[model samples]
Target chain A: MELANIENLLEKYFEATTTVQEEQELQAYFSQDNVAPHLQEYQPMFQCFTNLKAETSTRNVPLQPRKNYLKWISVAAVFVLTTSLFINEWNKQRQAEEAFEYFKTTMALVSQSFNSGASHINYLTQFEETTNKIFKTENN
Target chain B: MKQADFLHTVLPFKDKLYRLAKRLLVSNEEAEDATQEVLMKLWSKKSKIEAYNNVEAFAMTMTKNYCLDKLKSKQAGNLKLVHSNYKDENTSLQKEVELRDSVSFVHEIMEELPEQQKIIIQLRDVEQYDFEEIAKVVDMNPTAIRVALSRARKYIRQELIKKHNYGVS
Candidate 1:
């Protein structure tokens, strides 16, 4: 193909208007051993494309078993995480409830102590008042 | 997709995935990890893989995404100072050195491209995806893909000419 025609096709290719056959033609043109000197820079780009081969591994790594094992591992991780979070929250709530119960008991003990002290002071004042009244009446 | 079938279909592309991961991550260990992760993803979503029109492209996209994720994680971890020294054994020592130079040159130039353009080159050129397939993979219009590819090509050509003193039209 003429350079101009190839250039036109390349332009069409960029425009997304080239047919598959035209694309193959472009690939063929670029794949040639001899390319235009100016376009030699694009040789690698095209060769990279033409030389593109699917990757294969020589090492025989069994995929399915490994994949299944990974799946199980991920599942176990999620399960452990969720379960641990639940347990942590539950422990926190239990600790809070215990603290509140302890606080309530301490407040009750404090109230009882204050009540007993006030009763004892009132009883002493009544005894003093009675003794003073008796002494005053006897003196009169 | 049956697990067996999925493995059978995808196992063949492991090398391609490894190469893509190696190129993108620049570390053999990281590439292997990324490949395993990509395979795990594929295996887990076997049905989705079966639905895909092009499984290889799908796997390539997955591998690229995994590598990019690893890159981002590494960056976030403030570990960008580390250097990767992965070498391929298939090539002779001299050719391996040349390949490393070429890969480094390409990597530096790729960093100058926009993310979209870089990915386009990685998929279309390195991964060898066709335009339509790449368009699907990248979720772009075909015209946009072609333009992006041409622009990327032009940039690489310019850079090569400047760095190597090679003439380009």
Candidate 2:
């Protein structure tokens, strides 16, 4: 704020002993329109620092987010789980259907053998009846 | 680290890295590339970055080293290291500098300084880094850094006063 103080700060600044706060005060003092004429020569340096500080890189920094991998992993996990579950269920249904087909074929074979045996039994019964009729006629 | 963590921690100071790279390399495009390279390096090592006590300081050191390497390998013929080579080195970068007035004049004067001195001034005066932090970035002790900074500040002052007097005359 005071000329004497700025001169003192400038002296400290050039000595590279000024604290950051003190350096900021000097910059603040110089940035105003009414710097002391004697110190006008020093103004550009501080202003240049300010201007350089304001200079930003217009280039883009590409930082692809890391979360995408996690998202894909979870999605992959869900897909595997559903696919396995579906396959498991389908496998069980197929096994049951195969077992039923085997049972039907086995039952049909057993019934076919039993039906042939029943037809032979029917012929034996008819022979027995014919024999009994002949015996009855002979006894009469 | 996570991208969000990196964005909060490292990405915030990218401009600081850019400014330091720009100051050292003296070309916006080179600085931008250097900054991107440094950032990509940091990201590659992001998992271990948390091990650092000061990530920003580490990033600054990386930028400084990267730009110096770039200058040595690619632009050794074109880049100036001292005032003697100032005229030859002052080509495309000089025309591209956007500062319009006395600030530009000071910038030119700064361009004449030794590379180390220019970096010290940029880190201390423009970036507001403390001496210890600057010591880490520049690989100099705090006392040596202070001395170099004082010399640079005084050099700028002498040049500015000379220019002012010449203008008045």
Candidate 3:
């Protein structure tokens, strides 16, 4: 009776009609120490399922857990980028201010030199007037 | 979902994903890589994971797709469907050898099966998945899944019995 039941279940198993419970029963029967000689060949097939199910990956699951870190890194990158840009603009502004200061100093130096030249022309005019007065005195 | 929560949820079934990859890719290293890749992909989609009714089924589908893609790529030259990892330390040497040979023969027979049937058998026979879960993973109706599974199971039985008889004779 047991053998008949197993044979029936085995047929349904191959036909893909066995329920999970019936399949488990078949697997249990085959896993025993003494399966009937005719059904012995089927032992390894069920055993293979058991063995394969036991096979777990020895390799570690490489989960980097870096998603939150990625968000933080992007934020830092933006912060760095904006700060560098602001610094560049500030540097350009300072450069322009320094250049204007140099220009103002240059203009002051040029004006001072022009004022000295004017004083020298005044001296020459005064000397010419003195010469004219001396000639008039001689004529008198 | 939070990453930690997602990890908690996925860690339990990580081995199942690995097994599916192993069944498809047939190499430990490749299977491991595929599992990791699939996990990362799921992590990327964790926000949208809530949209799915069953994350496990979704993950299984992703694993199946990823492994199939890997097999199709040129780098999978060594990824032949060979299951050589069977071992039995308690049995005598001769019996162990016989067991290993028969097991590997089963794998070779599986190799001859179409990729769909192979997956169906893997999910149904090995993983003990129900028709509905198998359908969700394969995107096939339950009836078609059952037919393909029946065909695959019968083919393996025929080939295995033939080999067993030849060995006995």
Backbone clash count, each prediction separately: 1, 0, 0
Model 1 CA lDDT for position A24: 68
Score candidate 2 by lDDT.
0.87
Q: Candidate 3: deviation at residue A102, Å?
A: 1.6
Task: Give the Cα lDDT of each candidate.
Answer: 0.71, 0.87, 0.84
Q: Which pairs clash in model 1?
A: A55-B16
For residue A30, model 1's alpha carbon misses the true position, in angstroms, by 4.2
Best by TM-score: 3
Task: Quote the TM-score that chain A achieves in each candidate.
Answer: 0.43, 0.47, 0.68
| TM-score on alpha carbons, each prediction | 0.57, 0.68, 0.75
Clashing pairs in 2: none
Retained true contacts (fraction), each candidate: 0.22, 0.83, 0.58
**lDDT, candidate 2, A1-140, per-residue tens:** 88999999999999999999999999999999999999988888999999999988788779764345887999999999999999999999999999999999999999999999888899888998998887786546
Residue pairs that clash (backbone atoms under 3 angstroms), model 3:
none
lDDT of 3 at B87: 53
Better by TM-score, candidate 3 or 1: 3
lDDT of 3 by residue, A1-140 (tens): 28999999998898899988888888889888889999887887887777778888787766565557878999999999999999999999999999999999999999999999888899899998998887777556
> Which segments of candidate 2 are over 4 A away from where they belong?
A65-140, B75-100
Question: Which residue runs of candidate 3 sit more than 4 Å off their true CA positions?
Answer: A1-5, A33-38, A59-67, A115-140, B1-8, B40-51, B74-101
- lDDT by residue (B1-169, candidate 3, tens digit) is 7768988888888888998888888778778888898989888787898888888998999999998887777356764454455455589878867755877677777768888998898888788999999999999999899899999988988988898768733
